[model samples]
Target: MSLAAPSETAPTTDSKVVVITGTSSGMGLAAAVAAAQAGWRTVATLRDPSRADALREAAVDAGVELDIRRLDVTDEAAATALVDAVIADYGHLDAVINNAGAGHLGTLENETVADVREVMEVNFFGVLHLSKAALPHLRASSGRLITVSSVGGVIGQPFNEAYCAAKFAVEGYMESLAPVAAALGVTVSVVEPGAVATEFVNNINLDRDAEVAAAGAYAPTLRAYLERTAAQFLNGAQTPAEAARTVLEALTADTPAFRLQTSDWARDFTAIKLTDVDGSAVLGLTGTWIG
Candidate 1:
C-alpha cells in the first residue's frame, strides 16, 4: 500500500482537520470528497494505499488535495500510530469517521463462530479501537465522532444476525460514550442507512452454499419484500456525495443530533421505537396470530 501526499492545490482549512477510514470506496470516499470540497483538511485512509487513485481524482476534480494513507482498521497498533501521526501533523483533529465495515449473510446456526467473530472485529471492534485512539484529540479540539451504522442496527433483518449484532453493539457503545464525549465538548452521532446501491452487499462472505440453499426456499418471500422495500428507498437513497454532505452538516451543526437516519425506513424505525413492541403484538397482525 502506497501513501499519497496531499496535492499542492489541496484545499486547506484551520480547525477542520478530519480523519476518515475505509476511504478507498463508497460512503467513506464520498465523505472525504465532501470534506475536501468544503475546504476541510482531510486525512483519507484506505486499507490498500495503491487503490487511492479514485479518491485523489475526486479531490483533484474538486480542486483540492486529499492526503491519503494506508490503514487497516483491524490492526490496533496501526490505528493508534496513524492517529498519532495525524495529530502530529495537523496539530489537532476535528472529526473521525469509522466507516470501514463489511457484511455477512446467512442463518446464525449456519454461520461459524469464526465468521461471526470476524464480522464483530471489523464492524464493532474497529470502531472501538479507532475511537479510543482519537478520543484525546477529539477532546482537545471539541471534535465530533461519526460512525456509519445500518438500519440493520436499528431493526433485525433476515439472515443478518451477526451483522445486526455488530450494529447493535455499535449503537450501545455510542450511547455509552455520549455523556463522556459531551463533558469533554465532543459529540457523537451514528448514521443509520437503509439499502443504497453500493457494492457492500455484493461483497458479503457467504462461503457455505448450504445456508444459501436453505435460504433459497424463502427466496420468493425475501425477494418480494426486498423489491417492495427497495422501490420505496431507491429513489430516496441518498448518493454517497449526498450522504457525505449530511455527515459534514451533522459534525458542524450548532446542535448535532445523536442519531441520523438517512432514509424513510430508518426514520420510521427511529420514530416508532420498534423494540417497545412485544412478541405477541408482533406475531399478531390484522387480528390474526398465525405464528
Candidate 2:
C-alpha cells in the first residue's frame, strides 16, 4: 500500500468519501466494510498495510474495495496530508471515524511513565490529531466525526487508569468539539461501548514481567487487580459485529445521538444515573441522615 494523492474528481451519487482508521481488525475493519457496503468510497487506514491483508480480503469479499494505506495516527503531518488528499480525490469527506486505538491492561502504579505516555499517544493524541486534520473537509461536506471510545470514557473501572484516562480525555475532547462541529453542520459522536469482544482486549499489551520490574514496590497489587479484570473481560463480552452496527447507525441515521453505549450493562449504568443521591442516605441509620 503505497501512499498516493487522491484523484481529482468529485464524488457521484453512487459513492461516498469516507476515511476510517485502525481498520486492520476489530471494530474499525467492521465499520469500514459496513460503510463501503452502504455505497461509500472507503479509505481504510492502518498502521501497516501488510498487517491488514485479512481485512482487505474481507472487504473485497463483500464487493467493496478498501483502499488500504499506511497510517500511524500519531503522525500529525501525515494525517493532515492524507485529509487533504482525500478531499482532492473525492471532492469531499462524508465522515471521519477515529477508530484506531490500542488498549493497555495494568494498574497506574505498575505502568511506567513511558508506558502511560505510549498509551496516551495512541488512544488520546492519535484521535486528537486525526480529528484536527479532518475538520476542514468534514466541515466542507457537513460530515460526521465519529469516535470509537469505550465505556471507560464515562465510568472509572478498577486497574485501568491509563486506558481510562485516555478514554476520559477523548470524551471531554469530543464533548467540546461536538458543539462547535454542530454549528458547522457537522455532527460529532462518541460511541462509548461496553465490553465488546473485539480483538482490542484479546490483544491488549500485557508485558507483565517488564511492567512489574519497572515498578518493584507497586507491582503485586496492580498485577493481581489486572488479572481479575482480565478474567472478567474474557467471561462476558459483546461481538464486534453488533458494535459495528451501532457505529453504522450513528453514521447514517437522520438523528444520531452524541453517545451510544452497546451493552446491557451499559444500559443499566445509564439508567442508574437518574437515581437521587438522597436515596443512599435513606439506607443509613436515622442518626446518620442529614435532615
TM-score of each: 0.85, 0.84
Q: For candidate 2, write residues 42-140 as lDDT tens digits.
A: 888989756777686777678766666788999889888888777666677889899999887666555588989899999999998989988887887
Q: Residue 182 of candidate 2: its Cα lDDT? A: 99
Taken over the whole model, the C-alpha lDDT of each candidate is 0.76, 0.77
Model 1 per-residue lDDT tens digits across residues 164-185: 9999999999988888899989
Steric clash pairs (candidate 2): none
Q: What stretches of model 1 exceed 4 Å from their correct place?
A: 5-15, 205-211, 214-236, 279-291
> Evaluated with lDDT, which candidate comes out highest?
2
Q: Which stretches of candidate 2 lie over 4 Å from their true place?
A: 1-14, 207-224, 270-291
